[model samples]
Target chain A: MPGTETAYQPTDRTVPTRSRERAAYDRELVHAILDAAYVCHLGFVRDGAPVVLPTLYGRVGERLYVHGSTGSRPLRMAGQADPGLPVCLTVTHVDGLVLARSAFHHSLNYRSVVVHGTAHQVTDADEKRTALDALVDHVVPGRSADSRPANGKELAATAVLRLDLAEVSAKLRTGGPNDEPEDLGLPHWTGVVPVRTAYGAPVPADDMDPSVPLPGYLAAL
Target chain B: MPGTETAYQPTDRTVPTRSRERAAYDRELVHAILDAAYVCHLGFVRDGAPVVLPTLYGRVGERLYVHGSTGSRPLRMAGQADPGLPVCLTVTHVDGLVLARSAFHHSLNYRSVVVHGTAHQVTDADEKRTALDALVDHVVPGRSADSRPANGKELAATAVLRLDLAEVSAKLRTGGPNDEPEDLGLPHWTGVVPVRTAYGAPVPADDMDPSVPLPGYLAAL
Candidate 1:
């Protein structure tokens, strides 16, 4: 465990072999990165091979929840009586394209969090409801309250997996390219092209009433 | 094999358990999806557990190249004698937010490509050079020619792994939210919020000549 409450302890698996300076164990940074993304790449072993799938996820405190139909492979695997399915969930945001004068120095400015742990199915009724709401609200803040909650039948069909954020690390690269001193004078434009997620105007459903006003939470996006 | 050259034959793993309608084996669609993203979540088995990592990748024809320092674990694993390292490379682009009347129906409009294959280290110098050039060009079209090629020392330090895109599938969700007929009358806003990747103005390195005009390709972004 970490000596401080605000950070997570570095584990053998979480410590990167190279560029150790890029890794962070700050708890808040991990939560912020996880909450900002709408989807996460969840990886698990199947038949002795690795399988990675993009899925919706929600972070409630230090616990991360991912849901799918009960028949889904990962969820079903997590439901097994075994301690849980070992999974590595990762979230990444590309902030910029780092172009260097030397081809060897080219890299991307990105922030990514990697979680290594076992994922168990959420069995309690109330906890599953909280996860379901978090899943909906994670997409659009205050969405669960605005939309109708899942009915009993819908709840039964869904399987929620919970992974505690005990072993995690965020790796990031920022600023411009790191070109060598000799290559600085090369005749190539060297810089960063900033990349961001942009949200466009919302289009109402055709079946809905045109008078229905846009909610404040969505407009805030 | 696919009945025609225009598509990929979906294997058991490429075929999704649910939402089969969203799966596409079209070759061009798969390439377009792969070309649009800068980062991919790469999964490989590590120490008998699943490990997922976000890394930069370049797609050339039917092959995907991922590079890192020769000391990296995955690269070292791929360099081993037996066959190659089994990997699952997935790229996802969240196109829009699907807001439905019922929580159960909420989803994200996304385009994703999943490639299931074995990765082998590129030991041939010529192939490695081509893969490195492709990686640089993938960041910004027409960039490799403008930049200085990697030197002998740099080329020897970096390692590139090649994975052919023979087993691939593209899954996409588009348009607005799909609300149930009965729930359409709920007192909530229903619509689709478009999400896109926006590129910002390029920022040159502090040491770069201020007079260097921005390249046409970057300005076009």
Candidate 2:
């Protein structure tokens, strides 16, 4: 089933066994989580074992393009005659450290989105170029227009795996620690320490002429 | 063979097919990358399909412990009457966004470690407790001693999987973007926009007593 208009229906694979309350299938939430993060952990099976690697990804509507080189095994697999490479792509943002009164209750405040689907190589030249632009813009929104697009040689050397954002779920844990009633009186301090990604001033290339000013979009970061 | 006195020998799975120059097997580098992060993407095979999930993990010397509930399928599989589960655990920290002259050359400055090995359920109660403490302290070192240790009931409720750090590699990208000679002359603003994890002031739990001050370890973060 395509699910309702607002949310994707949860499937067995997308539903977590524990902490079921934290999982959500709202399409907007999924997109928000995916769009906010540029790096993703991509998992694929090889030689009957799981391999997880961190890579850059870009989301265009319901599809995700993972940047990789053509020499990579997973990318080669997707380009092969095989149907497609089944993968699990996950992105997470740790919001805070949940320090509870008891060690058992200690946890992290995080928002994570997991997508289960098959990834295929983007063989279409136009789609591949679009995906590359999306990947660049993902790192810094509107960056593709500021930089030179991939040339023919560069495009042919690169590999892009497009994974549709179907069978997706987002899990979140926020607020403060949930210590037990008995442990509340303990001497230990309980609270949440907020965590975030901070960006420092951009450094200009040593060889660049001073006249080339920072882009307005990157300056905003 | 154990490659050297201070580095783990490279296994087939630990080597990167591409960007081979960025891969390192130095034990110290691997430990540093693993210790600095609390969350990891744990990958395992489920029904012959790869599944990756974001979870908290702790490192004790050469052993890495992943926190999970007994109800989870991977944990259950590790506890079942069978060989250890083949898993790949990865931790990544995006240091900065490398804005290159060309979109094709754009990349991220990141440090990551990938461990591919078998994970066994920590059946020993002592090790499990130690792992739990390590997991807590990994979030904020020395905070484990400041908080109440898990009770017997809590210990029994949690499930842990221990993976030895035998096959491992640390991949890193630092410095600025490496744009091509021809593209360097372009007007594009090129350089690395540094990124880092920043921690804000800790917020006390609503129910906590005002007298209990923040611990020194957490305050340092």
In order, the B-chain TM-scores come to 0.97, 0.97
Q: After superposition, how far is residue A177 of candidate 2 from its true place, in Å?
A: 1.3
Can you write out model 1's per-residue Cα lDDT over A7-97, one digit (the tens) per residue?
Answer: 8899989999889999999988888888888699999988888899999999888889999999988988899849999999999999999
The fnat scores of all predictions, in order, read 0.90, 0.95
Q: What does candidate 2 score on TM?
A: 0.98
lDDT of 2 at B35: 96
lDDT of 1 by residue, B89-197 (tens): 9999999999999999999999999999999999999999999999887778888898899999999999999999888999999988888888988989998999999
List residue ranges in candidate 1 displaced over 4 A.
A1-4, B1-4
Question: Which 10-residue span in candidate 2 chain A carries the lowest summed lDDT?
Answer: A1-10
User: DockQ numbers for every candidate?
Assistant: 0.88, 0.91
